[model samples]
Target: MKTEAVRLYGKKDLRLEEFELPPIKEDEILAKVICDSICMSSYKAATQGTDHKRIPDDVAENPIIIGHEFAGELVEVGAKWAGEFKVGDKFSIQPALNYADGPVGILSAPGYSYQYIGGDATYVIIPKEVMELGCLLPYKGEGFYPASLSEPLSCVIGAMHANYHTTPGSYVHKMEIVDGGKMAILAGVGPMGLAAINYALNREDRKPSLLVVTDIDQGRLDRAASLYSVDFAKSKGIDLRYVNTGAMDNVAADLKAITDGYGYDDVFVFAPVVPIIEQADEILAFDGCLNFFAGPGDSNFKAPLNFYKVHYEFTHLVGTSGGNMDDMKEALEMMSKGLDPAGLVTHIGGLDAVIDTTLRLPEIPGGKKLIYNHIRMPLTPISEFEEKGKTNPLFTELHEICQLHNGLWNLEAENLILEKWNKLT
Candidate 1:
């Protein structure tokens, strides 16, 4: 079968081309992609091309499709999965595949790199390795966009789930946040940061008694505060504060004042900036855990850490690139119960504009950029829906749907979007 996709040949070289896909093997499955969200990592792969750790060495010679966050419907299920997964079954993928048992096994390779097809294409074949690793998950969500978003949400969940311990003479490591402990999200208010905020507030396992979200951008900080209000946190019996550090004369001192000069129990750094990272380290409580959640494209990106704090106060740092299948499952379960991370989505477009969108993702201001593969529409910001509705009736309907859900994207909005522009077979 022939399909169109965005293929990466070399650094800063992305080609939108049509190619023929081989027949699915007996153990493989063929899926038709419905929604693919452009991620910052996709932009990194596009700019780095073959030099990227995830891109296979021979990608320049054999160009590969680039995308990982996507959702689709099964078009052809192999004999092995015929009964278990039939045609028309909707699904999402945990793209971090670990086929080999060794340390260096397929950690860099995901759904959208060399040897494996990605969701940028109209259809992709599910490799035997992916099925064997159980990375392909059956999605029962109302829409494909939400299923596609689960991958990013899982990364946020993984960061929160990461455990750390203190070495107080004994080798035993303590797990979870200290009960009713204080937490802070440094340089938060971005899409993933907002997800972390939601997970920190809503997770039943380790709920923070006090949560503070800090950002330099007042606009972003205000949006986060409006979405997750201090009043709402008070109702939940938790103290929540949104602060713009840029406005403060002494940011670190102000943050410490919130915790009564004791510092935060857990701190999450959402930006790759070294200054921000250092600031996160500066505001740690004794035996505090810092999670470097952002994935930087530069391999040599270095940040200074206080070894003194690590040895004396037991302050430690950890980083996670992506989540496992279990994290994805947990995110799906939470979303099913109306956690509504869909508010993280701020922009939407169609496959026709995906190539350009992927190339310019980092520069684009806003949250998730959802792309409908079968649809042919321009990139539309959610904030412009009401204005666009004046000229286009379709956008007017979308505006109405969003209004019903408190001006946020919901299943109704997704269904309305697909109902207007789903031309797939």
Candidate 2:
């Protein structure tokens, strides 16, 4: 089979090319990739190339495809796994393969390590290890974008589950954030931060009594509030507040004042900035758990922590990069129950746009840049659909459909794109 994909050749080198895919082995499966959500990690991989741990050292000889947050339909099921998986089934992959013998060993993932498989391709051969490790997940969601987005949602789900507290004078740690406790997410108006806020509000098992989301951009904070409304959060029994720390005289003092000087029980740092990490540390209550959710591109990234609190006030810290299989399943389950992640996506593009989008992801503004693998459209923001509609019929229909759903992408918009653009395949 022939597939079109964006392949990484070396540092800052990405090429969108059409190539022939080898036949799937009996232990492998053939699939059609429909859509993928661009991630910052992909940008990092494309920038670092062979220097990336998940990318093979010989990537210059055999390039790997780029993208991981993807969902698609099964096209051909290998005989070895026909009973468990069948053709025509919709699926999403938990790309953190964690396999010992994968292309790049334990850190090997679909988007960063494999040659014929990745989210940016029209077709792919799923390796046997993916199924054996239970990373090939069946997604029964309405649209492929939600399934693709589940990977990112699982990350936040894992972070929330990873937070823990302790009882005095014991080695045993209680898992999960404090139920009905004060929580804060510093620099939390970005894409991943938005996911964290959504998960925290919609989670059924436990919830914070007060949820404070802080960011430096007032416009982004306002947009976040509009998407995840304070009224809706109140209905879910959460006191949601959006704060622009950029406008404050003292960031830490103003944030702590929100909780009546008691500080917060769970604090999540969403930005790699040193001040934001320290701000997260400052606003922690007794026995507070600080989750450093952002991964810095710099190896030398460091932030000051209150050792006095660590020894006397029982403050602690933990960091997470990706979600486990269980977290992916939980994200899928939440979507099945109608937890919409559309708020995270801000732009849409296609296969032709993958190379430039992946290389310049950090420079682009807005949220997730969702890609339809079979299309040939440019990367266009959802907020600009109406403006672009003046000269294009496709954008006109897209703008009308998005307007019906509060200017967010939905199943109708997805169906329109697939129906109209699949001819480009």
Candidate 3:
């Protein structure tokens, strides 16, 4: 079968090309991708090309498709998966595949230049390895875009689930967070940051009593506050605060005041900027856990840490690149129960615009840039929904649905979008 995809051949070399795909083997499944969300990691991979650790050494020899977060329907299921997974089954994927087991071990995932296909394509074959690793997940949700977001949301889930411990003059290490303690998320108004905030606020177990979200952009901060209101958090018996550190002359001082000088028990750094990392470290309490959640493209990216505090106060740091299958399952379950992360989507486009969208993801302001693989529309921002609605009746309906949800994307909005687009196509 012939299909279209955005393939990366080298550094800053991404091409939207049409290619023939071979028939799937008995253990493989063919999925018709509907929605693929552009991620910052994909942008990094596109810019770094073969230099990325995840990219295969033979990438130049075999250029690969380049997106990880996506959801679709099973167009063809192999005989082996007939009963287990049938054609028309809705699904998503946990791209972090750790298949190797012994001395010849190599830890890698299916996305980027390492795999034969990716989410950026109109269709992708779920290889035998992916099925064996159980990374291909069946999704039951109202919309495919929300399911596509599960990958990123799972990363946030894994970060929240990360545990740390202290040993008293001993080498033994333990894991877990300080229960009901103070937590802070730096640069917490972006796409993944918003997911973290939603999970932190809604997770029923071992949640923080006080959650402080900081961002340099007041607009993002305001949007986050509006989405997750103070009144709502108070009703849940939690203290939630959003602050724009840009307005404050001293960000560290302002953060310190928010915690009443006790410092944060758990601090999450959402941006790769070194200054943000240092600031996150500065606001840690005794035995505080600083999670460097963002992935940096630069291999030599380094930030100064207070080693004195590391030993004396027991402060430590950890980082996670992506989440596992379990984390993706949790995200799906939460979304099924009405925890919508679709609010993080700020721009929407079609497969035709994915290459440009991937190239300019960082420069484009907003949360996630959702791409409908079958559509051919230009990228549209949520903020311009009303204005766009004035001309396009489809967008007019979307505007109403989003406005009903406080200007945030929801299942109804996504369903409306898909339905309208299908009709036009």
Using lDDT as the measure, which candidate wins?
A: 2
What's model 3's lDDT at 301? 92
> 241-271, model 3: which lDDT tens digit per residue?
9988887877877898888899998899999
lDDT of 1 by residue, 107-225 (tens): 54554464446867788888777778788898875777778888889998888777566658877777656658888998889999988888777887768899999999999998888
Q: Which window of ten consecutive residues has the lowest lDDT sum in model 3?
A: 101-110
Q: The CA-based lDDT of model 3 is what?
A: 0.83
TM-score of candidate 1 to 2 decimals:
0.94
Could you give the candidate ranking by lDDT, starting with the highest? Answer: 2, 3, 1
Score each candidate by Cα lDDT. Answer: 0.82, 0.94, 0.83
When sorted by TM-score, best at the front, the candidate numbers are 2, 1, 3
TM-scores of all candidate predictions against the true structure? 0.94, 0.99, 0.94
- lDDT for model 2 comes to 0.94
Q: What are the clashing pairs of model 1?
A: none
